[model samples]
Target: MKDLFSSYRIKELELKNRIVMPPMCQYSVEAKDGIPNSWHQHHYVSRAIGGTGLVIVEMTDVEPDGRITDHDLGLWSDDQIDAFSKIVKEVHRYGAKIGIQIAHAGRKAQDAETPVAPSAIAFDETFKTPRALETEEVKGIVDKFRASVRRAVQAGFDAIELHGAHGYLIHQFLSPITNRRDDEYGKDLTKFGVEVIQAAKSEMPASMPLIMRISAREYVEGGYGLEESIAFSKVFKEAGVDMFHVSSGGEGPIGAAGRPGTHASYQTPLAREIKKALDIPVIAVGRLDDPILANSIIGNEEADLVAVGRGMLRNPYWALEASQALNKKVAVPVQYERGFRH
Candidate 1:
């Protein structure tokens, strides 16, 4: 009988409510040195003030070149830890827990002079053909992942999410369409992601939960779908993943046979499938802008949490508004009480 307003917990991470603000890339860093600036501070802290139970910072890379753009965030260097810590501290003040999505864009790194991938695949004609990582180099990237998670741990984040969806580095390794190598990593599609998961967990506190964002189905033909994803998800679960952020697409361009998910809660069924099939908790995302629909996902036991992406971008206080609309009592700042008077 839980709804969006219910508190939830896993291991050490406790959320005050079920509303999550999923990681959406800001691409707003000014230094081009992969450091988050004032923009990120205001962006995240505002959502925390707006009543989000959990606010996941965007795709932060493990290396400078691992980013999609020069402006993206990175935790490769210890110097970058303070800026993130500042955000996490302010978010905690507002009673919302914060998490960061650590990732490497891989072949999708738009600004890399030369990108790296599981194989030498160009995302498309417009993208550069990527250099495949040598077998030894793949292990090196795993170390980089471990380092990034370490920095996040130092930054005081309640949780960490490894991005394995959206045709990113981890996704590139997971997909047969992009991974054509004969190495052990290619031989076992889940190896890279599994290693990354294990490494991230090593740096996290025993109570801190580790979440992974994974595409449950690839859109392109010949690509793996729900069944294949479930198999690999089980591998990740055994590898120390506490939760799954179920999403779809990102392998290739959507074709006639592989259309994008456009309807509201279109991706909720996929989350439900994984939760039932694997008995693992999942965060249902994708066009879940309506608070009522998001709440139902929780009430129906469809998902453990619901992430509102674009809706949050449009309204930093989307959670607060949803609470009002749902007639659910939620904490509002004393200063903003007049504004939210019912």
Candidate 2:
């Protein structure tokens, strides 16, 4: 049976194991210029060395104004490409593949003087009431995504993930609760997201699969449920999304309907649903900190890969630890093998 220690392949990207390090914002981009620094290199390279099969860098914005915060990374400029390439090179040296999640924070862009969204809705009262994008501006954003992907390719990343979840720009457009546009974008909710996928795919090589992170369910009242997400996911799959990083509930503040809830494997069922509905590979994430549960998800065919977020933050060697915990004889760096004595 294929377990967490088993290899996973999608297109030309081959993971050493079914373990993935999902994008979690470090908010460590010290340079306001949006370029990654030594901190990013250390952060990612350490995970690679620690045995993460695929380390996905955090939410990297395609434009300065698209950042969730001023400290987030950006791929809008060529100057930033080489810095990312350096990290990719080091990660590869550890026999791990790496990806970047290109995204736009939209109305959630805390640092923008005035953020933009599909509609004029603010995420909440504390957030700015964003200006709605004109038809042309929406198209421009698509171009920006394409440009970012091209830059990622130049940086020699093994894979690319489009950030379309968490009530961000793409999710805002995808969710009916957030998007209330009256034009083409609104009429066709998936249009903007599909365009972004197509744009990203245009810049990616045939071997480089494009993964998309999506909120499989929104938790707030009137927010989308599993049915809605599945419908859109089918569209995304057809639009060339090679994999879905299944997550849930970032649409807005949790309402009386309650939140997605915090518990181990809470979102694994969501990933399973999408995988079954679309017949596509998926990476299950969310509180999957237990190596046993994470491995079971893969072993049972619940998800193709499992992303360990908080677990990884707490222990960079989570993957190596998992291998030991599962009693699987996997490769460990010679330097660290001595430390894993049975």
Candidate 3:
């Protein structure tokens, strides 16, 4: 049976194992110019050395104002390519394939003078209300996604993940909770995402797989659940998405009754449903820090891959430690092998 330490491959990307370092924002770009610095290079390459099969970089915005904060990463300019290329080359050197999560924070863009979104909605009472995008302007945003994806390709990333979760721009367009527009974009919620996916695919090599991180269930009262997610995922798959990084919530506030379960693997069922319904591969995330639990999800076919977020944050060698804990054989860099010697 497949497990966390087993090899995994999709399209042109080949991984040493199934453990994935999913995109967790570092908020470390202090220059406010969105360039990757030594912090990013070390942050990612260290995970590669730690034996992670995949290291998906943080939520890198397509434009400056699209960022969640001034400290977030961006790809709006050609000047930023070299820094990311350095990370990519170093990650590849250590045997891990890397992908970047391209996203727009939309109304959640805390640092934008005035953020933009599908509708003029505020993320919450604390966020500024965003200006709604016109139909033509929405198309321009799609081009920005296209351009950012082109830069990611040039940077030598193995794959690309469009952030369609966590109340971001794409999510705003997909959910009626935020997309109250009367235009075609609102009428067909998947249109913006589909266009973005198609545009991204155009810039990527044919063998490079496209990954889409989606919120399968929004936790708020009126938010869509598994049924809605399955339907939309089907369309996404048709639009060139090779895999789904299944996650939930980030749409709106959760009342006492609407609150999500905090237990481990609570979101696996959503991933399982999407995998079964769409007959496509999925990466299950959310509180899957335990190696045994992460392994079980893959072994039982709940999901094809597992992402360790905070666990990796606490220890860059999370996969390495997990390998030792599971008694699985994984390559350790010669310099670090002594630390993991059996």
Candidate 4:
């Protein structure tokens, strides 16, 4: 019987447990050159030391302007590769598998001189309206994704996750509410995402599984729902996605109809549904701060992995604490074993 302490395997990657520390941007890149600094090193290494099975690094953009902020991490240069490699080595020493969430912020890049998106639209008044990408330019973005994946592989990451959620560049191309282009990309909403997936796959090793994070339901008016997301997810799967990280909303402002409530394991059901419908593995993330609930989701076969977002932020040792609280015999570091007795 698999539980939170059970080891899980996907392709060539084997996790020590089911507790995943999902990507949450640290925004500590001091030089604004996409290179990660000491803060990133300490932040990720601490979680690895705390017993997380998998620690996914935050949304790292493929290009400088693709970031949500100037401080976000990036993978556009060879110079950035060495720094990420060091972090990956440290996390591995702690026995936690590390992955990177390669992303593009699109119109949400508040600091970009000229943010680019599928269409010339602004997220809101505070954000600048992005210039629409020409058909030829779209291919360039796909190449950038391929380059990013290559860099991740060189950095020694065990897995790769493409950020297609939260109204980012890939999500912008996926969402009909945001993608209003009349070009081929708009004609086929999944085209951009599919191309990106294929591009990233080309650079990945055959043994590594590519994970995609997607908004299963858009909360804003005229946004997509589960059915549409599943359809696009199917396309992505065929295009070479191995797992789905289910999340919701982030298309527009909160509205009566679009607002999804804040509750524990609220997104687990969506993951369950997708897993059953598509016969694919899933990672359920939301307010799953409680160990019992997170374990229950895995025990019930609802999701293959549980990503604890805010809980991990508040406490880097959330996984270690959960192991102790659940009375599961997880291996604590030799130095910290005295602090966490079974």
Q: What is the C-alpha lDDT of each candidate?
A: 0.92, 0.92, 0.92, 0.92
lDDT per residue as tens, model 2, 287-330: 88999999999999999999998899999999989888999888
**Native-referenced Cα lDDT, model 2:** 0.92
Candidate 3's residue-wise lDDT over 1-342, tens digit each?
788888888987888788999999999997899998989999999999888999999999999999999999999999988999999999999989999999999999999999999999888899999999999999999999999999999999999999999889999899989999999998999999999999999999999989999999887768898899999999999999999999888886422123654778878899999999999999999889999999899999999999988899999999999998899978888898789866
Question: Model 3 clash pairs?
Answer: none
* Per-candidate TM-score against the hidden true structure: 0.98, 0.97, 0.97, 0.98
Which clashing pairs does model 4 show? none
Residue 162 displacement (Å), model 2: 0.5
- What TM-score does prediction 4 earn? 0.98
Stretches of candidate 1 above 4 Å error? 254-261
Q: Where does the lowest 10-residue lDDT sum fall in candidate 4?
A: 253-262
Instruction: Report the number of the highest-lDDT candidate.
Output: 1
- Report backbone clashes per prediction: 0, 0, 0, 0
Point out where model 4 deviates above 4 Å: 253-259
lDDT for residue 335 in candidate 2, whole number 0-100? 85
